[model samples]
Target: MKLITKFVLLYLVVTIIVLGIGGFVSYHIIKGELDNELKWRFLDRVERVTYLLEQGKNFESPVQDNDDTNLKIVALPNRVEPNVEIRDTLVWHDRLQQMEHNLKLVAHRNVDGTSYRITTYGALVESDDITEAVIQILLWILGLQVIGAVGVGFIVSNRLFKPFRKTLERIKNFRLQDKNPITAEETSVAEFDDLNKFVEQMTSKAITDYKNLKEFAENASHELQTPLSIIKGKLELLTETDLSPEQYQLVEDSQRSVKKLSRLSESLALLTKIENHEFTGTEEVNLSELIKDSIQSFDEFITLNGLTVEADVEDDVFVHMHPVLADILWTNLFQNAIKHNVEEGNIDISLNSQRLRISNTGNPLSSTPEELFRRFKKDNVNSKSIGLGLAIIKRIADQYHYTISYTCEDGWHTVTINLQN
Candidate 1:
């Protein structure tokens, strides 16, 4: 749930409990006060009736009394104890022809040697009636509170969360390589302000780190190229010097090692560039055409390896990729296939709208299928292979969010590439 929603619900729950308790207390308080009021009204009526009796107004006859409309006063010619009594009782209403609850008050008085008893009755509010009344009042109050709470939540929640929503948008669109990257937006709320401040610090640090890393990669590649080129030149000159057969063999081995080192450096630099997103230019590449061209280019190598080819490339199979990266991806794929293929074995290539699969007849791999995509991982550790070809292919595929899988069965190594988004 949203924070605003949770908070508002909690507040409403508390309000309901408070109102419920208040209603309960209010019912009892009001009922008590009303009972007292009824008693006082009954007592006042009794006093009026006593005064009329002293003035010789006969209360026995309704016409002669001229008072005590809701009272029954009677006298006995004997001395009796004087006291007052009040209670609730049920009485029959002659006109309404029904029984009704009432507050009945009785007074026994010894006035002028006569035991005078005066009774007064008042309409009583039943428990159910009083409860209903309190509930109505509480309902009205609760309804108003609910409406007000919802209104305030709607009004305040949007305003309060506006900065938070904008912060989310900023984070969503943030790009480390963008010239103008996202920075934290200023907010009035302390929590949101702190969040924005932290975001600003982290983004600033990330941009600084990215710049340093990218600069280091470029500088390192350039610096290494110059020294490697000079060393290669010196080795070529050293090869020209007349030397023993053993010395010449050593020179040849050193030259091969230097070339391998040069290639390794280039492959590593390419991997770094791909990771850094330097291949930003992208276009729809015709995979079918590219693979056909690649196969033609490596035809001599395939012939030298004594391998047979079977290509079922679908026409105009397109993928969104950088032209250079596309070429590198296919080149690495074809190279891996040919370099690992057995003599007089078959190479089967399939391409369609969904995926591309290349299966080459080769010896069973010594490493796991997953290890084929890891850098510096190879089937034969002693081979001249730099162990970066499949790694580079996997990295390029990953950069474009493509799925690449490897499988080996029956002396056939298969690599599948799915480029669909």
Candidate 2:
């Protein structure tokens, strides 16, 4: 729940509890006060009746005054009644034809050596009347309080949280590639200000770190290329000299080592560039055309390895990606297949809008398919792989936000890539 909503609800609960208690107490208090006032009036009637009897007035069936005070007086010939008695009882109303619950007050007095009993009745304050009135008033107050609290809480809280909402929007759009820090609007709230400062610091540091890493990627490839090329040239010249067969073999092995080292450096540099998001300009590239071209280029290698490739490529299926990365993606897939297949094994390639699946007949995996995506992980460590092909492909897929999975079952290795964005 929202903070404002919780606050409003809690306030309403407390207010209702307090109002209920106040109403309960007030209901009884008003009822008791009305009863007391009625009793006082009844006593006044007894006094008046006693005085009239002393003045030699004769007894009658009943007597009533202008205030509707019902009174009855009886002569107690040679006997005295109780000093005073009061109770609540039901009396019949002749005009309304209903039983009316009322207060009856009786008093005994002696006048001129004669005793008489005096009784009076007064209407009581009905508890139900008081209860209904109190409830109505409490409900009105509760309704007003609830309406006011919800309306004001939402309006005020919207303005108060505007800064937080803006900060979140800016953070979502922030990227290290932009090289710009997120600057939030100034606010009086301390917590929001703290958040703005922290995000700015974090993005600023990330951009600077990406820049340093990018510079290293460029330097690592260029600086190492010069020495490697010179050494390769020297080895090529040494091959022309009159060396023994064993010595020639040694030189050939050294040349191959140098070439492998060069390829490894280039592969690592490419991986770093992809990680840094260097290839970013994306266009609709026909992946179908790229796949067909890759298969044709590796025709010789496929034939030499005694492998058969089946291509079921659809025409003009486009993927949004950098053209250079597109080429690298399919090339790596074809290379991985040819490098790991058994003799006279079959390679199956399928492509359409929704997916691209490549299944090849190969040996079982040494590690789980997931572990193969990690850098420097390989099935055959000494198999001239350099152990970076699948890792590089995984990075390129991640760069384009593609889903790629590897699985091996019954001597068939499959790599399924979901082409949807």
* lDDT of candidate 2 over 299-349, digit per residue (tens): 999999999999999999999999999898888888889988999999999
Task: Give me the overall lDDT of model 1.
Answer: 0.85
Q: TM-score of predicted model 1? A: 0.69
Residue 277 displacement (Å), model 2: 2.0
Error of 1 at 266 (Å): 1.7
TM-score (all chains, Cα) for each model: 0.69, 0.71
Clash counts for all predictions: 0, 0
> What lDDT does the true structure give each of the candidates?
0.85, 0.87
Q: Could you report the Cα RMSD, in angstroms, for every candidate shown? A: 6.5, 6.0
Best by TM-score: 2
Quote the lDDT for 381 in model 1: 88
